[model samples]
Target: MGFPKHLTSAIIRLELPKNDGGLILTKNLYLSCDPYMRSRMSRSTEGSYVDSFTPGSPISGNGVSRVLDSSLPGFKKGDLIWGVINWEEYSLIKDTSSLIKIQHIDVPLSYYTGILGMPGVTAYVGFYEICSPKKGDTVFVSAASGAVGQLVGQFAKLYGCYVVGSAGSKEKVDLLKNKFGFDEAFNYKEEQDLNAALKRYFPNGIDIYFENVGGKMLDEVLRNMRHHGRIAACGMITQYNLDQPEGIQNLFLIVAKRIRMEGFLVFDYCHLYPKFLEMILPLIHEGKITYVEDIVEGLENAPAALIGLYSGKNVGKQVVAIAHE
Candidate 1:
């Protein structure tokens, strides 16, 4: 494949395999955007857990695809699946382990890129396993309008908890409260003081805080956590773009309040994927759970969609609809 002149530029081209054991896939759909992809764009000293996208090479991301040709067994033609792949119409999957077979198609195929895939599992493990939420507890989620945050808020509400969410815009705040059924929703951008904002909503202090956007928001949350409060550290979106991350001055509060803070990666809990599906699928069928998606049309709009995540431009789960499955 020929390289584009710019770092952000992505162009499609045909190329022969440089090695064997590679599988070719026809890209059925592409996920529009995610904040993490921004990190991969830069040339950094810190190595990526997932390999960085190379210049002139086809950019890859989590997408739902169909197997076209395979050297590997089980994954034959017509197999529907989702995983990391190129931005082009066709992709050569060098690592077959990254691909997973899609067994159920009764639900929307786009779901495999978001809700039924990485973000869904992230919410499940972070809220259930890491936070250890209990019934009737108070739960707060930062970036509540986002992909993972939206699901977290809903799951907490379903567990019979008082859920409050903070989002950047008025529309997002309204969606959190009205559509997602959060007990209360506030526009953090309007509030001058996040600590005071939290106190106004959660007078008793927060029992569980789902930490999505870090920096000052996290610092304020630390001061407001009740005794033995659990803080599930997901992604720190606030600090992701900054050259120097903000310092949390209220570290002593964790010790004083006996708060428990744990950081987690969803892949660490992949074993629980089946169990998560078992728990969440029934909730979906009963209409106890609702998912929101902000979908962009075509692969060409993918770059803008991904970049929108950082600016809080997306209302819900950001996905790119490449083709109808």
Candidate 2:
């Protein structure tokens, strides 16, 4: 209701594990601050994919780490890996199965916490798997300057689609148009009416929507969607903090417009990680795809960095760099 508090920092002593039945001890390098984490700060209902972070507990999220010790098969000391780890300096990862041993270290390791990790997968699956497109499809992305949204727009462009994106500030909108090469970009905050803005951008009606911010944006999008338009509901950042969620009065457009709206979790698409890396790594190196990261230096700034996400304070992917090596 008032100001919210997320875990900041704590001092914890670490010990090398005795046995190695696939248990790995790693030093945390970088951690991710994402919109979904906000939902965990509150009490979630049954069947939620992730559980709420308990108070006084070391909060866990996607991170890139250097293996300090690993008695497990296929893992060894000094191997760089990225996966789920606690928000701490050193972490003892018990289950190494889900961990991704870093293959390409040429790119920034902190990228593993962002563009090369969970957020990247979310954009890939949501756009490619869910929002199947043909050339010249009229695409729109909400929160377009974000980590995932930026990638989505670029992916659509590379696939030969005309893309438009909406952000909250002039700077982000500029990044979308100039840096990301979106056909058009707008600051949603400056718009008096969202539906009018969508219409202004998509005069022919939008064919695909890569949704990041939901609620009113979704409702406005529904009104301007073309027949058989596809909506990839990646996240609802706008509704995450509201005590009462904003109801979409235009949901009936799903039937009227014959629209396909689908929601997906990145975990379900983990099997495609190798495939994703194959596609993104090449593009990243070739300069065909570009990524932006907003990283803070220390764990002490982690809480503010994370909380800043809600207000769109960060320009791109938000990361916390806990250590150098």
TM-score of each: 0.91, 0.95
Candidate 1: residue pairs that collide? 3-56, 32-320
**Tens digit of per-residue lDDT, candidate 2, span 232-305:** 98998998888788999999999999999999989999999989999999999999999989999888788898
What is the lDDT, from 0 to 100, of the residue 27 in candidate 1? 52
Q: For model 1, what is the alpha-carbon lDDT of residue 20?
A: 55
**Model 2 CA lDDT for position 199:** 92
Q: What is the lDDT of residue 150 in candidate 1?
A: 91
Which lDDT tens digits does candidate 1 get at residues 111-164?
887788889999999998898999989999999988899999998988889999
lDDT of 1 at 52: 61
